[model samples]
Target: MTLRDEITNCRICAERFAATKTRHQPRPVPWFTPTARVLIAGQAPGLRVHRSGKPFTDASGDRLRDWLGMPPEVFYDLSRVAIVPMAFCFPGYNAQGYDLPPPKVCGQTWHDRVMAELPQVRLRVLVGGAAHRYHLGTKAGVTETVQNWRAYAPDTFVLPHPSWRNTGWLTKNPWFGEEVLPALKARVKEVLND
Candidate 1:
């Protein structure tokens, strides 16, 4: 099946949304190109992205650009990067924090197919715990930490969420700036350069 078809038919996150206090309608269009070299696997959108319908189109986008040292022009280019967030829609939040989980339906319904379409994804950025947990499975844990990132290097990389809440996290994990930042840039440059 085509990427768009698989995404449109996703029932994973949608089911969870139905049970939430706030809900979001899903839009699985804008299937990205296979040439996309960077795959940003993030948590579902927030209230803002739900309204805008563009992935990482909020403050988080700004932080992500800062980390990547990329101008908005290059960062927003779908041809260069594919943004397949864990949950395609903004899966409303809870009082505790974000919420319980990103529907099993998303991975079960569409994730594999979408990844298949984007063969050029060289680096998959696992943003936030849910994205990391789902993508990395039991291999990732809260105690596992972003500090000892080498434990999960190369093909997969863990990142603090780009949300404002992570500014302190960015500060605490200075190595993310000193070490991971350089490597991430080099990787992006290599792909963008090519």
Candidate 2:
């Protein structure tokens, strides 16, 4: 079977949170097309995405689209953009209402196989610290990685999560909006046009 087929049918880590079964389900939400040039490598699906079976369908998604300077039609078109999170499923929330980190098993089990199917991904947008860690390794923390965007130019762009939780970070980092954003949008358009 193709990697997509295998991923869609996977239940390998379903039992990771058997105790939290009452709160969440293992619905692997991933979007991709083998020919997609731009890949949005984000964290796991949030509660909304897991419920909707769409990778990004909440306020965070709206903000992400804004950052990319793309309309929903173009952003959601898997033929051009691939949305593959570090974890395929929602990893459930904690008592404080924040989502738990995606289980390591998800990456260990599926990333390589799924990535193999996406040979055409030219510009990978790492959408959060976790994604940066996985794709860019321990080269730098999120702040440093994102600050040094030029190092990964044309091939990757590291970004903070677009969730409301990071509103303060965005406010503090004016350069992200002024310098990084324009470059990000241009790179995205360039890759898609390729």
RMSD of each: 2.6, 1.4
Ten residues in sequence with the least summed lDDT for candidate 2: 16-25
Off by over 4 Å in 1: 9-18, 29-31, 95-100, 142-145, 151-154
Please provide, for model 1 over 69-97, each residue's C-alpha lDDT reduced to its tens digit, 9 standing for 90 to 100: 78888877888877877767666776555
Instruction: Give the per-residue lDDT digits (tens) of candidate 2, residues 88-124.
Output: 9888877677788988889999887778879899889
**Per-candidate TM vs. native?**
0.84, 0.94
After the best TM-score superposition of candidate 2, give how far the Cα of residue 182 lies from its true spot, in angstroms: 0.2
Q: After the best TM-score superposition of candidate 2, give how far the Cα of residue 116 lies from its true spot, in angstroms.
A: 1.2
Among the numbered candidates, top TM-score falls to 2
The segments of candidate 2 whose C-alpha lies over 4 angstroms from its true place after superposition are none
Could you tell me which residue pairs clash in candidate 1? 12-105, 12-106
